[model samples]
Target: MIRHLVLFKLNEGVSRDEERVVAGVKAFQELDGVVPELTFWECAWNITDRPIAHDFAINSAVADRDALTRYLEHPAHQAAAARWREFATWVIADYEF
Candidate 1:
């Protein structure tokens, strides 16, 4: 399986509770039902106050690289990512499990 993890940092002045941010989060949360390639999906806001901690995270798994690709290309994921791009930057790590 491929484990796909991501940490998102909100842009300066962007609040996690902002309407658009909340909607974007919801969009990602809704992806598990829409993407067939996903074997696992978990996402949440981070509560830590540490400087190195990101504002949110996503932990997901798929069968392999191809499945991961399909998940990335899914319309719902693209839409959610685009929304996030307006107010945040993210880092991702993908590894075989």
Candidate 2:
């Protein structure tokens, strides 16, 4: 199995309550049932105010590297990411379990 993690930090001056950010969050939250390659999916906002913390996170799993690739390349995933591109930057990590 592969664990795919992503952490997102909103761009300076962007707020979570903004229309675009709200829409972006909803888009990602709706991906669980929309993407077939996802064996597991969890996404949510960060709870802490620590300086080192990211504003949002995605913790998901797939059957394998190929599955991970498909999940990453899926059109729905791409579109959701594109929306975030307008207000946030993110980092990702993938590894075998």
Candidate 3:
């Protein structure tokens, strides 16, 4: 399987309670069942207070590179990601396990 991880940092002055941010989180939270290529999906807000910690994260897996590609290209995933773009920036990493 391929593990796909994403870490997000909210834009300066952006609050998690903002309407758009809440909607973005809700959108991602619903992706697991909506994206057929996802073998696993988990996402949440960061609980740590450390400066180095990201504000949000997504931990997910797929069967292989092809499945990972399908997940990335899926319309629901694309739409959720687009919503996050309005309030945050993120980094991603993928590795086979």
RMSD of each: 0.5, 0.5, 0.5
Task: Give all candidates' CA lDDT scores.
Answer: 0.95, 0.97, 0.96
For all candidates, the clash counts are 0, 0, 0
Give candidate 3 misplaced runs (Cα > 4 Å): none
Per-model TM-score, in order, reads 0.98, 0.98, 0.98
Per-residue lDDT tens digits for candidate 3, residues 3-83, read 999999999999999999999999999997999989899999999989999999999999999999999999999999999
The sequence of per-residue lDDT tens digits that candidate 2 reaches over residues 1-97 is: 9999999999999999999999999999999999999999999999999999999999999999889889999999999999999999999999999
Task: Report residue 49 deviation for candidate 3 (angstroms).
Answer: 0.6
Instruction: Give the alpha carbon lDDT tens digit for every residue of 1-97 in model 1.
Output: 9999999999999998899999999999999779999999999999889999999999999999999999999998999999999999999999998
Which pairs in model 1 have colliding backbones? Answer: none
